[model samples]
Target: MNLDTLKQLDLDDREISIYMTLFRLGPASIRDIAGQTGVNRGTTYEILKRLAARGIVSYFPKGKRRVFRAEDPERLLQLAEEKQNALKHTIEQLKTDIIPGLHHLKPDFSSGNVSFYEGDDGIELVLKDILATVAHQPEKSYSVFSSKSLRQHLYRPFPNYTTQRIRQKISVKVIALGEGGEDAEYSERKWIRTQGQPDASYIAIYPPKVAMISLASENYPVATVIDSVEIATAQKVIFDTLWQLL
Candidate 1:
């Protein structure tokens, strides 16, 4: 019998081996099962005790000695069902108890908030937050200062970000700082000619927040999210002024 699926029930390799050996050999003493499975007698007896407690194995007295054997394999399906029901209960508890308690611990946004995130996964989180913010707002638009170098860094980790944004119908007005970005479906591009290489960074201005992202090749990718209405409004004004000039 294929016993690989037994691991899902949290059985270790030795326990699985001993159980299968018992299943094959019928009722057997610990010494016999241990020798067949190559596990020591003491450990095999402990494993059998655990399996018996879980109803996966049963023990009966053979004279003065106890003989152990596997229960029906159908017990595995019952164990899986129990695990699934437990997961559903945990989800319900989180929704009803845990999340509400967490919401009460949120910090005040009026004092201004700054969050630092590092690595590619951290950058994706910031991008996802931006998308979520725009998705909830009525305006459905945001502004970006798109650096060519930054895009090169970002495309590798988030190739489908733009596609997902377009699919959500969130529009962006972009001020391209270097070369070679085409207008996408939900975006408008305005170019700013630079004398030399532009700084390797991107700025995203959205409602009540602004995000600054660094695309430095010397280190891991990083992003900073500033949650302040005053700062975001000022950045939006500056972007608009440059948008008109370019």
Candidate 2:
């Protein structure tokens, strides 16, 4: 009998052992359950009471003695459902109460807040954040400084990022620092002439945030996101200035 499921329902070792013993033995006396599970009679009796309270174990009078039995195995599903419902209610409470309360404790900073992420998954997170942040903006658009060297690695983590952006009706303006980039729906691209290999950095300017993605090592990516209205607006101004020149 797999007891892992029972363990998740908050059953301790002794309680689970006694419960399983009753389940297998069928209508056993307290003394018999204690012996089978190697728990003392006093502890065994308490565990049975706890399980009975949970509606998983019950007792009936067998002559002068009470015999305990496990409820149908299907009752475990009911326990899981109860846990799920309780979690749902807790999540609602957190959103309305706990989260806002915790936010109040956070330090208020005007600017220079930065977060870092590493590897392909991290790059994907940066890309997703860009889309999500831009999608909610009044104009639903953002600006990018794209480099040819980092462009291939940038989308490896999220190859369908463009598709998702177009689906959301979010547009992007790209100032390409090197050779190649594709034009797509809801996007505008401009190229810059450069000597030697272009710098391997991609910068995105979305209001209230700017995300920069680059290589920490060959084929290994890292991203840093800056959260500040002043910095993002400055970057946006610079990008637009360069955009007009090109």
Candidate 3:
């Protein structure tokens, strides 16, 4: 048997080969197991020792020769359970120690970090994080929309989103570029529109944070965000300027 399934259980190449060889050959001497698996004798011995301690294998003496046998295939499922529990426990412990520092990273723009999100779940989490940080503040949010205007855009949900925010007394000022030039989601609000200022960009201001989504389809974006107070203040100024003229 190939080691494909066993590798995910944190088994090294030699360990996997040794385990599979025992399962296939059954109750064999270490010398024979090593020969069939093409694993060196030293590595095979070490892994076999570990496997025996884990209760996945047993060694017994028949007259003078030592014979090793696999415990059961059920041991693999047990190993998977052990891994899951260990990983979850470790993650919980790490949350208090490692995650706070992780969240505290300075978003130094020059450092060049990029995250590629694949599905709706990924995009939702990104937007959710933005909303979570900005929700408590009573400041206006500025946004630039792109594919938002295309036939399959997020037009319907956006208007409701704005109205809900307005009901919550949070003002939203948007400069819709290409698609921002399209129809309104709610008729009561007049949108300040701007388009084609050399580069295609979508801008958003959420109090002390600002984000811009750009140049991609519903599946992805060439986007950026800034959480600096000074930068956000400057964006708010630029947004206010256009809010006046447009």
Per-model TM-score, in order, reads 0.68, 0.66, 0.57
Candidates, ranked, lDDT: 2, 1, 3
List the lowest-lDDT window of 10 residues for candidate 3.
150-159
Kindly list the per-residue Cα lDDT of model 2 for residues 159-236, writing each as its tens digit. Answer: 999999999999899998978999899999998989988779999999889999888767799899998878899999
Q: Return the candidate ranking by TM-score, descending.
A: 1, 2, 3
Give the per-residue lDDT of model 1 (tens digit) for 20-85: 898789999999998898888898889999999999999999999999989998998899999999
Q: Which residue pairs in model 3 clash with each other? A: none
Q: Tell me the spans in candidate 2 whose CA falls farther than 4 Å from its real position.
A: 1-53, 60-67, 72-85, 110-112, 131-141, 158-170, 184-186, 240-246
- Best candidate per TM-score, number? 1
Clashing pairs in 1: none
- Best-fitting candidate, scored by lDDT: 2
Stretches of candidate 3 off by over 4 Å are 1-3, 101-174, 180-191, 195-198, 204-246
Q: How many backbone clashes does candidate 3 have?
A: 0
